[model samples]
Target: MTFRPLLALLMALSVTVTASAQSAADLGASKPRKESTLPLLPTASEADAALISAHLLTRFHYDAQPLDDAMSQKIYTLYFKLLDGEKVFFTQQDMAKFAQDKDKFGNAIWNKDLSAPFDVFNQYVLRAIDRMNYARGLLKQGFDFNTNDTYNVDRKNADWPKDQAELNDLWRKRTMNDWLRLKLAGKSDDEIRKTLDKRYAGYIDRVKQLDSEDAFQTFMTAYANSTDPHTDYLGPREAENFDIQMKLSLEGIGAVLQARDDYTQIRELVPAGPASKSGKVHVGDLVLGVGQGATGPIVDVVGWRLDDVVNLIRGKKDTTVRLEIVPADQGQDGKHEMISLVRQKVAIEEQAAKKKVIEVTDGGVTRKIGVIELPMFYSDFGARSEGDKNFKSATRDVAKLLGELKAEGVQGVVMDLRNNGGGSLYEANELTGLFIDQGPVVQVRDARGQVQVQGDDDPGMAWSGPLAVLVNRGTASASEIFSAAIQDYSRGLVIGTPTFGKGTVQTLIDLDRFASDPTTKPNYGALKMTVQEFFRINGGSTQLRGVTPDISYPNNGDEKDFGESTYDNALPWTQIAPADYKPVADMKAYLTQLDQLHDARGAKSPAWQLMLDELAQYKKLSDRTTISLNFAQRETERKQLDALQADFRARHKAIDGADSAQADADAQLDDGLNPSERSLKTELKEQADAKKAPDPQLQETAHILFDAVGLINANPKLAAEVLPYGGKQGNSASMAAVAGATPLPTQNSAGQSGGASRAPAAASSSGH
Candidate 1:
């Protein structure tokens, strides 16, 4: 049951990551062969699933096995489609070879050993190629169907795909109609080839015309991404260039490209990536053409698939490769617009993190709030603790950031975790420790329900002050861990809609590790199995339900659309006994009032109003089955929406003259009154005023912490020896926030750390 180190699985099946040696025979036909000559391959249905499962684990970095062939089939087919066909590229000859082979390789490959012929391995190899080719072609010719590239990652770290019908069509029609168009255009085969060449020049500026590339990549990305959230299969050299692998040490235009529908489109333009350095390319640019050297006619590659297109763009570093692009959001009728860009080596420094400071007027005082965006929770797991390593750990960096923010006299801090696609688990635990005093932040229960509690090693909190943690739906896995802990401990006010659940843990299990003999399949693909589930200390599982709303915000993610919580047969929500513990403070009595206040202001606030309208629209389009088939009506609806948005944006932008009303508020301030603040000028003023209450969300959190502190103060005996200063924390029962006045981390002027505290505060639970 135990697969040694899953590290190989982690590094296995990486895109553009070529295997040691894959001979033509290895990638060739899979026909009947004598099984007794070597090791026996799994032939039984059950055995097939196990073998396939093993392969999946090896590739996807999963730690579990499939129960049957059906399960393996579902996973394999789904993954194949997700991968935008498959990784191995083959030509028509390859397909024909497999088709003609009949059954020469081995019985295991065939579904029917006793009947005609069914070598799935060989058949799929060819089919996968066709699929990839088709996917590529579709990207070139713009898609004609409505496609949705959606994934669901819930709190438990599980993911599933949505919009299957359109997705399937996107895959199927990717290659068809191309040669037919050339034939119908009455162009000779040679003539068509020549046209293809001249059209290549048209791509220099249109390289950003990534319409096709984006679709295919998005379509297939779910395959690789669906795996352990890592271990992608890079189809061509273009994929490798975009991977940003420092270890490989290749240099080229710093642009990431993917096959969306037909063309190779840019996924992101690294800030200093050669493409960006040229000042000609931008993220979301669609590449329609390319030019190899200095200056010439741009290649007009309007309908080429990604592989062929990428092959044309590939070149050495410092070589001036011209690119063509249609900037994002600039297409009208999807016309072939063009702009040119040069290629250059992408600098690594540009990919590093950046920080910003925002000031929000609270309680009539302008306080600086620091914002740090983490793209990935990356940390060099290989060279840590045991080696002399200068590793980049999100936790360590964040701890340092807290110090800097505190020194800047920032009263409240907001940890922006939006779009943080997750990284190391150790880093997640360590990051949570920076805010919490440190304990078992999360529990990892394996497939058999064996739980391993992950705790913090650090005793010092980087910052303990009024804090706000911001999240959107994209926050997942390890991300969910930190957020879940904060909520369970009532550490911070959870804002935004529900997060991407994705709480399930996956471990890559390589079959090569279990092979009794090495002669069989030396190295098979990996499997990304769901091996463990994460649970919060409060007993609530951060599984399919994900993190619930504390203070909801209008965000770009569809709350009900994406995230693991929306998947079928996902793990259910459950909880274990609450671990014996205490938090910084409680805000029960405060939450009620705060919620009421938020409800009131939220109704009046334009932001919330707009969000409500958006949510209503979302409700209407909750399911495609429910949508009208009337195309005319849909167009009319689109027009109406465009007009509505235009008006809102216009009015909001012109709020200047419309809001000479601010003059009234300024006049009130001149009369010894402040009107710009969301709440009262002071505690005294708040107590006196019947109106102008603080936001319910903020008030609720503050009041909870305030009351929790008071409760502890009133029952000083409860904190007696542990009140002001406590000894080292022992078990869960005695666990409390690190005690001391290292500036009670607070998100408010009153110094209430969002989730961490100077001392363990009283605990209060409320329902409703």
Candidate 2:
């Protein structure tokens, strides 16, 4: 079924120029009638909704439940969440009016009727405009920042305001809080006003920028999310962007951009990309203007749309593009730092698996432990599918690294999968194959409830020695699979915090291919549908309850908001029959000894103690959902936190001594700054060593591996238990797991360049 263009839907709906004259509806109650003056935004027609609804019910995995009245109400409820996540926009009465058609959503969607959703969007636009006007007026009427009012930063769970009056009061405090935050940041009153004025203006522009396509995508996603979180609709452009991200090789500057007010901010640098390698551009830098090669007139992109700015920046390889950037450290003084860059095919190789050997002393004997940091499980699928002999994939790269490590006589291996958000499913399976001789790696259950066992039967093992997998809350999806399989096989010890718990597999389907009409113009787009759930060979699923580490450290990230458990409609974890497999050895008792060793070592280490304290403070800050509007109170809190942070850095630096400056410089480089520029400021050693420092997690994992090596050596019998299954049966496979040098993009509120877009859905897959 070829999905129609959003414009078609818009045309079918009343055009703004053609809208009939009608009476104005009060902002207060009085149901929005068809004749209301509110400009109706374009939305899915009954035909559009019916086709999508059919696709969801018939083609989606898990036999996606029927679109009944209950689902309709869910879709309606989710729409509000997506539009006004903070619960600060829509009022109680507005919700009540929208609720009248709550159950009608499913039916309307089934019929391809988008009147209700469109009508609601129109009302939202009106409300937003009204609020924006109120906010602009307040910018002129500055208030006392010394007021004792506290503005809640997060209002996701708060009740909607009863009326405009209540909302005005809330916005008043909110405005004060915004102003105070800037004041505390050291901005002058005049500067603060300009910054906020631009910010608020940018917000208004964003609202106004919403077109028929935005509405269709937003509402459709909400509807799809009611069925499952992973399922989402991406517009044609968004779909292309998704492809670019997944491929991790884009023909651009190789810098991830995020919209911040009227500016496109450089969030991070893709390692090895032209911009990163040049070492001139830094993260947190803002692009104020763009110019073509050599002396092309610089186009001020300050108020340009994000996509428009992106288009201006992106060009063919070898092309020169100059950017006027605002230094990251420089507050919004509007000063520009101009830099020129030649565009290239920036491969995200930096995030790729990298190998390093660290020496750890245990029992007065130093063991050379190899560490392989696999950022994201990625693969050059195009090359692999073409049967290229030198296909680049996570598995292939790691296998090569294993050989090098073994050649180097490393006694143990630590696979650092920390912050790996996961990627190719095929790579995950193949990576697992490198460690194990053979066995089912993961179980895949489709919409029909049929389970397909995906396994690696490669007999040629790669350095099957003492192993450890380092993870954190950012580890997820394919990374979780690899770790879980390792844990199930008793192949390695998993370390770090609980993972992000994303086990479901998503397949991007081109909606235009499914269109009923073969010759439709402007193909609708693509749908990323969660088609299957991944289960461990041992019958446990790694859905919401992500693969828990065998050993853990102090977790500072907000777990409530970070993991899959945060989603309300995520698939519940479920279990199935276990695959035929035998573990190398039971490590439960061994883990106890390892944990004790870690604790004892941690207790004596000041660096470790400092990290724990820092984490505690971080968690305290993260848990806060509100801040005082009083400038003095906020300022005092900020100073205290800053003092504590400074002290921690000092202690940390003291601990590193000679390596401190280099480490600090490298840490600063993470924001995409030029290492040379930063190095000039610090008394750092060579730039090469600057990037290498004492990684607590890697250190801890190496130590644990040393202990594992000791235990295995003490019990020679356990070491002798060799792989039993193999035969070269094949398949390809699959967190903050690393973006490996290709630094995967980060997402934020203002349309980040990369990362999976979230829909309104949550829950856990049922599993062990």
Candidate 3:
């Protein structure tokens, strides 16, 4: 089945308003005239839209349940989390007052009564303004960094303060932490004071700028997200942005951005976009400032709205946008780097699947292995609909690359899907077809309990020689589908971490279609809701559990911080009757031996050892929830981290230098090429140089595949048992027996009998 273009769901809901005649006493405020800002009130159109949205969510959503007291509590809790996730603004007393109508949120949405949510949001505005003012006041007094104290970095589960005094204490430490970060970054006391004064004032200004639309959107989104994290309500402006993104019309740095606390964080880089090609920014990096052109003044965006930050970053094609970002690996250490990228439309050619060959030497034998790196499952649906057979697609590009690799005489191929967040459900099926002759690839079950099996009807195999599919936590949806299919069919060994467990499907529904009044037709925005769930051909749903690899590798990222499993209300893993399909080959019996060979190599390889050590250091940093307030201790920690990063860079440089020398030697053999061919080779070399150092994971995978090929060639019966198209029996002098090679102790790098355990690092969200 064809799928619609996937849009990153934006939850840009906040509280704001204009002044009304209602007195502070009438509105249940403790006092009045603290600020000249007015309160926001819901409009009639918003109320009507909310009621209609509630009906659609309750009636049509996959796994929809009654919007009763239980759902109301979920909405209530989520709403507060949305408003004050750090638990700094709202006090215990405020929560107590809000709890009285906590169970009434569901009924309020159903009956078009927005007063309860509106009143709660208005109260939040007052509390937030008070805190900002308090923060500004503390900057004047300065901080004593010598104090032996600690500040909790993550307060998502922290309790609300009891009263104003308790809130003030929290803000005191918060302000001190802020000041300490700036000081450590080499800013003078005067600069710190000035910067903070502007930041806090900016926060208050942004809060005051929220209108009724913002409040309603937040409330409605809270209700939608209570059912599932993927279900979201987009306001009119957000809906328009989504359309622009889908059409690939927005000219910008091509980074998906989101608001985290007071900072705008990079969620994902659009594949082949300016940011992705720049090789500087990364997911989870926080944007601290933005500038225009090559020499524009940097504008501090610490407390700016996400939309405002996005606007500042976007520019005409060929123009440059500069970003000041704190790297994700560095946490909040206050050190940031500047990156400048030329805004450009995403190039489809850059995103197409690419092929390269690597040589693996094992047990005195050398073998050629081909690697196909697919960034995403893209297909030009518009072109295809217009009967353009030459339209680019993941499957078509991969098919051509496979033919080229076969011509290059590679013995095995690794389908690298790491960091591929999935697109084009149709491409996923067709891509799977390129592996096996023809069979069912995936199963989909709608909300009505009807299952439809999607498969390859074409009877042809592309390159069926020894195969391996590489994946990681960033692999989701269609990527998961393709990986799971290969594993289920016993066609290849899946290596790397577990796939991102995003098995559900969402479709955008324009709320304007449900409008009874013509005047409000297109003003209601849209709702992206979960309409179906994906199931594997083996009867298991790739929901919370995802797809476990045949041979697991070490992953530094924390699973809890990313993937569909991170959503508290995510759909449960389930099973259905297995689809009718035949297995091509079984690799289960060979996994133990492969794992042993991999572990032996990993223990001896310096690159592999360095990677493990780096992961350990990163995990240690990521696991910390609190940071030292003592200036001396913090400085020491920062110095140690800097040293570690320097060591890693130096080691990588050494390795790259060796690789570059070999690459240069290979380039010397291209003298006989035509002018166009030479130019293409030069272009490819430049692209390769722009990428980060060679991936240790890809090299290790090639080693494993080489071992498998040797084993198949040495043991004639093994090929018939594990090879789909019988055995290609005939061993050359180079194809030696892998079993004859002495095996090292089976202990893995982490000293476990199995593979390495998943480590803690930044998690990549789906479709970002």
Candidate 4:
């Protein structure tokens, strides 16, 4: 399939490269390090090859090109960036040696040779070992907190050190800064030294653990990213993790785990899961140690492999596991707590759509707004393929929720798509069908310039009342498509900041499934390649420019650091001819008044003000790349940050009640678990009817919807202002005239590359 070519729409996102084609010179260049005399790492074999990437990209990539020197340049730069992101390990001399073979990467990869990249990586490992040893040695020398020095935490744009002396100097300040940070955290000299020693040792061990598969995956990622940021390859172990995530079910604590610096952090709490229900463990909590059951010595999980930590946390249902957690976002001090939890199956129902009705009063009239939180655009593809009519899906659940809302006499409905990183593409179409009559929802264009319009065929409308879609930076891919379609059709008002602009679709192909050698084990892993680009019915691609809410709120994510625009290789945004359809109404006509009402209401909300203040402080810290190493200076800064945090928490407490009850309950639950079957009842009863924190964003959106209802009720014609082609052609008496932006590119949508053509999925097809 092909796609239309228009001017670049979005800013670049990011890239990476790979290694082989061994030489005597390369073998001789390998240097042993004193940090750790690890066993010789295994090398890649043909059976675990990456020939699939070259073959698939040339055959199916949206912008397929020959493996040539031009592409190799990108791979070269990307590989180095991946290996030494902070430019702390490799020196200028090291970079010069790698630069010589920059353009040869493509030819080597295409010919199944990887010696060059591997040799480069070997050098990197030695350099890293040397640096890590240097940092570790610093822990023995007591640091003087009175020294006035600063460490640049972000060195992506910094120059590579010229020699060992220059690199050593950089490491000195970095070590000092680390020492100062720990000191300010109230760590004693002995404790500080031990923690730093362990951290550096962990780094060395992690490097020693690297094998050929790990190296290949990293290089392959760089190679794939040379084309697009989304295209990627997952090794055998990574592939297993991916599958578990897609299924939204795992035999673990049900906490989203992420590697943050040197610690494994709980990124989020999955509702109904052991963690969330425990109410003891919250997001931003870091796992420092893990223990089996409620007894025995706890093993330090800090600096441990993410998968290993996950394994430690997982067990059979009713089994007990203990976690030593350090509360994050509280203070930098090394305070910690121990919590015990009984493991259970993390089922999909825990993440299903949930509904709550909130009453909002506007002009003395109370309006009940039904809110549905959609965590993901999930679907039971396995069940659906088996022809199960009762299969679970986001669309089906939401449709049922809409019906119930109607029964409850809700004046409006708010679909909360916050932090929802989209899933099923088919669900986006089906969900849009619930709000509007049959019409085109999204458009898809392939590499061959063929455009395919994906529309809703279902005529049944679940709810035709006032509606709003709430989104944030985390809402992406399928979520973007659904929201864009709703906006194009003018069926609902979108509220919140711009979303994550991910307009491309990916197709995962299991290379093992199609291997020619029957004797080969089915473990070649998988390749997720970008196959198509999606467009809204109004002819705009949500590539780099995400869906803009009709009424926006105070943004917590800065455009410079977050969203598609932050990526250096993200697909550009463009436009095509608007899809042939008529909008249900001109929702844009009420945007001005809605904005006014939103501002007026927000001015009176202490919660909104507190959120803004916190956001501002977050941005300030995020923008700083350098940190002072002086103990006094660092302590003052920490104090200021603590003040901001304390004030914010205080304001939150005043509005949302103290967390004393929740804390007490958490302590009770942690101590109550019996590590056996009898522990289940206590665990289950603790959070059976727990009340969730009120959502300020949803409440704000409800008020905005109330304003929308008030305007529409005052002038009913405004609700029937049929604007054709998303208000591009002309405006009606009820609609205002606004100049249209660039139209989406019109081209044939077919996946054609290397003189090959292939059928493409529907435009709204999701690559989840």
lDDT of every model, 2 decimals: 0.44, 0.66, 0.71, 0.67
Residue-level lDDT of model 3, residues 307-385, one tens digit each, is 6566577566777778899998887666989999887755334456899989888668888888999977765555555
Q: What would the TM-score be for candidate 1 when compared with the true structure?
A: 0.55
Instruction: Please report how far candidate 3 places residue 509 from its true position, in Å.
Output: 1.9
lDDT of candidate 4?
0.67
Deviation in Å, model 3, residue 186 alpha carbon: 3.4
User: lDDT for model 1, on a 0 to 1 scale?
Assistant: 0.44
lDDT of 1 by residue, 1-768 (tens): 011111122112111121111011121221211111211123333233234443554433333333244433343333333322322233334344434333222232234231112233333323433444445444454422233322221212222213334334434432223322343335455654444333322222123222222222232223334333332332223233323321122345656565333344565555655566656565556677766667755765555544344555555555555667676556422555544444443344322344555555434534355566665555433334345234444655666666666656554456667666565565666677766665678777655667767665445455554445667787777777888887766666566567776666654344345554656654432333455667787777766676775766655536554666555435567777665555654434245544665667667756456446645655554533322223344345556765665554444334424333233232222111112111212322433332332223333233333333333334545433322123122211122222112243332221121222322111100000
- lDDT order, best first, reads 3, 4, 2, 1
Q: Count backbone overlaps in model 3.
A: 6
The residue-by-residue lDDT of candidate 4 on 632-704, one tens digit each, is: 7877877776665666656767887777334323432212111211222333344452435446788899888
- Candidate 2 vs candidate 3: the lDDT winner is 3
For candidate 4, the per-residue lDDT at 406 reads 57
Locate the minimum summed-lDDT window of 10 residues in model 1.
759-768
Candidate 3 displacement at residue 693 in angstroms? 3.8
Best candidate, lDDT: 3
